[model samples]
Target: MNDMLQVARREIKTGFRNPWAYSFLILFCVFSLCLLVINSQSIVQGYSGVTGSMLSLILYLLPLMTLFLGSFSLTAEKEEGSWQLLSTYPIGSLSFIVGKYIGLSIVLLTIVAFGYGLMGVISGLVGMSFDSTTYVLFIAFSCGLVLLFLTLALLIGSLSKNRWQALTVSVSIWFFAVIGWQTILISVLNFLPYTWIKPTLVALTFINPAELVRLFVVIKLGGGSILGPEYYQWVDWIQRSSGSWLFIAVCMLWISFSIMVVYWLWERGRSHG
Candidate 1:
């Protein structure tokens, strides 16, 4: 436990120093302000066009920022021989990795909070009409993305031999996860039997953390009908109070499953090394 905390503490310091982390911080703050300017003319209430637009813009920025920031942090441990130094100690791989996850989560969430908090304050001062519920939802959506995708980052960093490889794969994943989500799903699901498509789509949605969280937020914001007939039941259930807790449980399962896989992989590599 102490070792995990130590690693977490170290990670918090390193994450703040990472140039890539700062680069994203600057970009997010600027983008949030840009969002503020672009939607200034409209009332950004609930899940209106303005708030939807804001959500879309944030979706693009946050995931990639997290992936890069997190993957780089893990890879740095390898490149700098920090892992080698740690091997001399009795620390378990799980402790070290979980520590990194905890630490980096703080750093990334801090960035999210600051970006949105600044935007909220500025919006209020300027008399923008966005409500507080929208901010709460946005913050929840952003935090979920961070916690879930950081698991992928740990996996990517563990798989990668160096930073360049990590960078390449991370961007590729970001593109697929965020940009190409619908196209790829539609293309692949097209080949399946008509009856299979819905089930497959549902399964695939759960498989992708970005899509999962995005869908949850969309449904919460009263956009579930737009998801088409396939998700009618699922969306309806999720909109209910009990369904909200179920969604949270699924996210917990996602993180737990990913972390288990990461630990197994780390243990395998350690044994071989």
Candidate 2:
């Protein structure tokens, strides 16, 4: 536990020391604040609902932030030959993996928290205080989405041989997870001759972080009535039963799969070398 924490601390320090890392944070903050301000203005003008509109802004930004920050974590280390340095320590491979995740998760969470805080302040100024329950739900589920993205990127980084490939693959996966699923769903329902596309789509929802986050957000914030009735109905059902459970289940699957893939790749690299 102590060693893992040390590793996490070192990772955090390295992030701070890197110029690109600091730049990402600054850019994210500026973009997020601008988005909140723009959307809140539209909401006040009776153009959109606070919850749905704010959530839409977050949905757009979160995936981009996740992809950029996480895609290079392991890949950069591998490129610089620093990844092997950790192996000299007594930490188990699993501990090293977990430590890396912990460090990245903290950084991502800080970004999310900052964005949420900025949004919340603006919403409050517009006389829109978040319901305690709904706020908690939104944060929890969104964090779950972040965890899913982080794990997937880590796996991609471990698998790819270089930073460029890792970045390309990671961004591609992020695109699919964030928006490609929605495009594909629309096309599938339109092109395919399936009467039960809803059920199939619901199944696909488990793998779609953007959809899951949006569902929880819409249900809590009251959909801008932006979603079709079908999506709203599904969100209502998930809300009634427990979206948190589903979020946890999906996140666990992503984390476990990532761990397995990273471990396998690490072994393969060692053996081939």
Candidate 3:
């Protein structure tokens, strides 16, 4: 535990030294503030309207930022031969990866907290009523989405032989998760039997952390108003299945699955080398 914490501290320090981290944070803050200011009229609906809009923004941006950060962090170490040097020390591979994840998660969470907190403060100042419970859930779920993508990014980094490869793959994944997946799903839904569409959509939501996060937030903010009536049934089904906890569990599953894949790939490469 102590060693893991030390590794986490090292990663945190390294992240702080990087200009990209600061840039990402600044961009997030600026965008969040702008969003709040622009949607000032909608703030009368409480946090739900604002949070829904922010969820859309987060769905698009957070995955890309996390993917780039996590991929580069690992690939840079490998390129500089630092990972090899570190292996000579007492740290195990699991500890190193977990620590890095922990450190990155902390950084990401801090960014989310500050950005949302600022939004809350601004909304309050503008006389927007507070929905503290809903606001807190939105922040928590957004952080969970970040952790999911971070794990995925590390897996991509571990699989790639170099930084360029990792970057390319990571961007591809971001594109798919953010844009391509939805396009494909929509096209497929048009052709699927009416009976199959709902179940398929539900399954797809579980498979994609981005979609799942959006759904989770939508449900928490009180059902399918944001997504229209087409999705209300899906939301109802999730509610029946006790979906809030289920969604959280599935997100944790994504993190675990990605980490397991990274460990396997890392071990295989080490053995071969």
Best by lDDT: 1
Task: Mark the 10 consecutive residues where model 3 has the least summed lDDT.
Answer: 41-50
Full-model lDDT for every candidate: 0.88, 0.69, 0.79
Report the candidate with higher TM-score, 1 versus 3.
1
TM-score of candidate 2 against the unseen true structure: 0.80
What is candidate 3's CA lDDT for residue 127?
81
**Model 2 local distance difference test score:** 0.69
**Candidate no. 3 TM-score:** 0.87
Which residue runs of candidate 3 sit more than 4 Å off their true CA positions? Answer: 44-52, 125-130, 190-199, 225-234, 237-242
Show model 1 residue runs off by greater than 4 Å: none
lDDT of 1 by residue, 131-209 (tens): 6676688889999999999999998999988999999999999999999999999899989999999889989998899
Displacement of residue 166 (Cα, Å) in model 1 is: 0.2
lDDT of 3 by residue, 164-259 (tens): 998899889888777798798889899999899878887877677777777766676675666766588757766665776676677778888888
TM-score of each: 0.97, 0.80, 0.87
Residue range 1-273, candidate 2, lDDT tens digits: 988898788778776676766676677678656655655443332223555555565666667667666767788888888867866667766677778888888887876677667777777787753456556655765686687777777777778778789778877876677657778878777865566777777777766767766665556555535677667666566556576577567568768877778777766776576
Clashes of 2: 0
